[model samples]
Target: MVGAPVPALRGKPITHRIPSYKLYFEYCPHGDLHDVIKAQVDEREVPVPRVRSPGGHMRVQKVRRADGRLVPRTNRTSNVPFHEGFVWRMFEALAKCAVAMERANVLHGDLCPTNILLGEHDPDRFAIWPTPKLSDFGSSRVIDAMVASRFTPPETMQMNFVPPELGVMRGDWEVDGLKVSHRTNVWQIGLVITCMMRLEFYLPETDWRTGPSSIHPNDELHFHDPNQRELHPHSFQHANCNYSPNLLALVRQCMRYDPARRPSPRALLQRIQARIPGSCGGMDTYTGDRNGSIPWNKTEKLRGLKKDNEWPLGDDAEVVDVF
Candidate 1:
């Protein structure tokens, strides 16, 4: 399977006497997938008339209400859903990443929109950004089917992004017989895509009454209902944004509550490749050069970069000439 590129470590780690370490990574200018998904749901405020204030500064026009209270005029806005093609591209990119992880026998416990970062857009590769790197490996671990059956994810995991199997567990927080495998990654990839399609954060079913209550101490955590139809992509699909049946079916397959029923990462990648038109050549192909070609560098025409040493770091740190 053609594995997606991950963010490269720019330099070796910098160790300090205080037992702290610093690492530099490739800069992703467009931010993460969460930012992109948020942009879709976020309303772009319409420009409103401004009035000169007593201080001679332009300010939003205010109107007096019936109660004699002045309020700024509310700006009109509209939700713009992501394009169907863009969603498909994002799905394909993430699917490739899943395949890579599966091959390495690693399980990214936290696979969410925030963890999937976006690099600069490269038109020569894809209509949208060519590279969407899977990042933040702090929660990742080597996969072990036996250990996973008895494993219970920590409460810190992003509750909304976890698969139904992981989200809806026994009151004791035990996974029971459920195995966390590549299917888990598939579920998260589907969820991220679903969020992109719906243009909002996907909130799974939760019972607030039973959660962290004096009466139900065991039910302190939120549990999703696996049987809910809302878990399916079709339920949240927008009529205005008509995605292909194949894409929807693939996403649905990934979100299957039964981990054993979901497609493997390689299988998922193959399915995604089938939907994409033309020969699967270049970076998308499994046989393609993994490192020789630099697609992210193609962004030179798209934007200018700050001189290497001039790049900003935290107040406590300064740039070092590692080269």
Candidate 2:
């Protein structure tokens, strides 16, 4: 994997409209960030995925010169096939990120593939991909809304990564406080893992009737009660797939109908670490460093980012308009 320098990182302050809370957040760096970009983004109460609130603004190298400037520029992940081992690594990184956010009383409500970025990427081939960094905190919440209906309903929820229980909430049932919780995050994580493991498990937007993706709506309409096992769809049809029994079981537990049954982030991390030895290692290990390497925090000095001065946008870095 080719290493690239992420010079700085920044977070902008944002205000929550519904609950009215001010938040300043940080991004999990996939590679070493030389300087912590201290620049504050423009203050706006508007809502937009990936760009809103404390998630901040970043100036990325729009293109790279492997040899010359003629080559096309590249970035990020989605619909990308991942090996089981690579997926496990990604899971570990995400679990660490999730634990950090939870400690700060934050919930990454949207944990879909679209929101995940591969730290180091090779557009040509996806062999042995880099550590995954969770991004797009637009839907994140300070308070746990899993059980409560503070957010919108599941049918109206357009994202593909939401847990089954979330997909079925409706009407007064939608307003119930117990609808979502930490377990909801657990379920979303499980779904992402499942998708990463078996791309076949990913539902084609056109053909939603088949496979595990279909289980949610089917379960919602026919198997409302968990006890009613007859019409309820089973998630584990992947016996033919290569995943070990232990990993498969973990995914099932996360996607459980009862949010109470899901594992806490700490517990989930332990489970993942147990399955994969030294899963939660430092930056060097994450960047595929085999030798025993010190943690990034101990060695790397963090420099504060100045909003205007630190990183002037490069000529090649054109801002893409976001709707």
Candidate 3:
């Protein structure tokens, strides 16, 4: 199989006497998947009114003429869901990456929205805008079933995106001989896609602890239990969007409770390809620059890092348009 189509390293690693190393990679101008999902969610919850300008360009409507008087403006929430085509394209791209990693015998212990970067939009080279590329290999490891059976998730790992098996383990590796495999990656990809579908950072009905913690410690286990229908994805209602049954079924298959039941990365890729109108034959080539200007401003970065309460909704939050 071809090598994983991850971000190309821009330069050689820099070594220091302090035993630290620095590596550079291609810059993704569109930020990460988290930013895209958050932008879509924000647009749905609080839409920005736009008007056609004299030049035939759509611009944000800052003011309106009412009864011969200028009014500040008005805004309303929208129920538009994310485009199904875009979701399919993203799923296909990430599936190719997952397949490559599996062929190379590598497991990305942490595969979440934040870890996936976006390349610039190239209409000529790619069918979809903003290609998704897997990034941040700090938590990746070579696959070894025997060794992985004794491994446990790190404290910094995002609990929400973790597989149900790892969540139940809870630092107890000796109790169960669960080997972290490609199925683990399947679960992560499913969770990420689910978040994109619901247009929320975390799953619906997630009980975030009242304290500083953003997620309840036992949330994953609770969702895994058959009796907890409220926290399960099957019970959660999707937005009024045209999501196909085939796509939804594929997601459910990937997130099955039994790891043995989940499809391999290659099989998942084939399923995603079948959904696309004209399969590109394989993964689409990303033509975006390896070193490009960073698109995010100060406010966007802050929003990505901190929770809603931590960052106040000031003028900056209101004025900034979703990317």
**Best model per lDDT:** 1
Which regions of candidate 3 deviate over 4 angstroms?
1-4, 13-15, 43-75, 122-126, 151-156, 168-170, 173-177, 204-237, 278-323
lDDT of 1: 0.62
User: Residue 43 of model 2: what lDDT?
Assistant: 26
Per-model TM values vs. the true structure: 0.67, 0.53, 0.68
228-253 per-residue lDDT for model 3 (tens digits) = 41235552225565577777778878
lDDT of 2: 0.48
- What local lDDT score does residue 41 receive in model 3, on the 0 to 100 scale? 52
Q: What's the number of clashes in each of the models?
A: 0, 12, 0
Q: Lowest summed-lDDT stretch of 10 residues in model 3?
A: 293-302
Q: After aligning candidate 1 to the native by TM-score, how far in Å is the CA of 156 from where it should be?
A: 5.2
Please give, for residues 264-307, the per-residue lDDT of candidate 1 as tens digits.
Answer: 99999898877766422233332213553334223111122223
Pairs in steric clash, model 1: none
Ranking by lDDT: 1, 3, 2
